[model samples]
Target: MNTSPTNSDSDTLRVLAQAIAKLILRFRFSRSRFLTLLDEELVLQAKNNDPQANNVTLSIRTGINRRYIPQLLSGEAMHSKPERLKMILEDLKWTSQKHYQSGKVPLKGSFNTFETICELRASGTLTYKAILEELMKQGKVKVAGNKVEIISNNSEQDNEHREFARNSVEKVFYTVEEIIQTEKN
Candidate 1:
């Protein structure tokens, strides 16, 4: 009759749940979105064991309802912020190089300036303004009267920070390599 998780198992689950909870809160991710992504990931894992995995099998393995599986996996996967920031910097670097004398791009544009770069590089779920604001807040960019200037690569410390962010993004989004391989095949 005693079917609850054992003390050690419960503690382990609690620690993992707590860490995930903190990550969600720190990143301002919605609870429902997180749940959906968790379900999608579980379903993916289930498929690894049984290639012909179905909703019922996924639900049983993941302990999530079969009904929610479809809806949860319908949305696109999210790319982490550090990855987007790195991309923005890359695009900005190009723009800076193209306009070497100025070293800045116009902040305003419908499809040509920083806006277009953000749209192409960052997640569509994020607004154009939100991405720009985050970059500005991180001191990776500065705003002029009508342009945004990248504030990087002038010193060793800035390069170190960029390297650190690149590494963090690669670690957190390592699954991207798997997704790419699957898509290719």
Candidate 2:
């Protein structure tokens, strides 16, 4: 099965959102060597490219305030809302489809209530709950009553925990593969 991100419309939206984010960062830092006119042209291009795209939804996805959408679009604001931006990005590439498809195996712990976990499961990853469990185990996610939440708002730390969990998963998979190979021998 093709698991490419391009297969889903959400993927397009995700990419667009990310690109916009980069633009926001560039605009904020005032480091653009290009002329101000060029920067203005870029923002206008972005605005024109997706005027129909729900700005409010994008705000929700990016964790930016809906009211700020006008400001961001107007070139009055430069900084992206860091928290919401991370959530939306996470929603885009949070999990593999295979894990959700199985529907039997449990996740670690942290992914239980993640907004994207259920969607990932629907897309064929492990069940959302299973992913949540695994996330909790590694401290990447926190949960109460099946609703997974982020324990730390720190993006760097969250990324680190995710890496740790991925590594742990790989090690476990290797062990299982070894056992299977031994049995076959």
Best by lDDT: 1
Residue 16 CA error for candidate 2 (Å)? 40
**In candidate 1, which residue ranges exceed 4 Å CA deviation?**
1-10, 16-82, 99-101, 154-185
lDDT of each: 0.71, 0.50
lDDT of 2 by residue, 18-62 (tens): 644554453332223223434445445555767676766656444
Clashing pairs for model 1 are: none
Q: Let me know the TM-score candidate 2 reaches against the reference structure.
A: 0.23
Tens digit per residue, CA lDDT, model 1, 89-180: 78888877775556688887874578888888865677768988987886778888888888865678767756765565466456546654
**Candidate 2: regions farther than 4 A off:** 1-89, 92-117, 120-122, 153-185
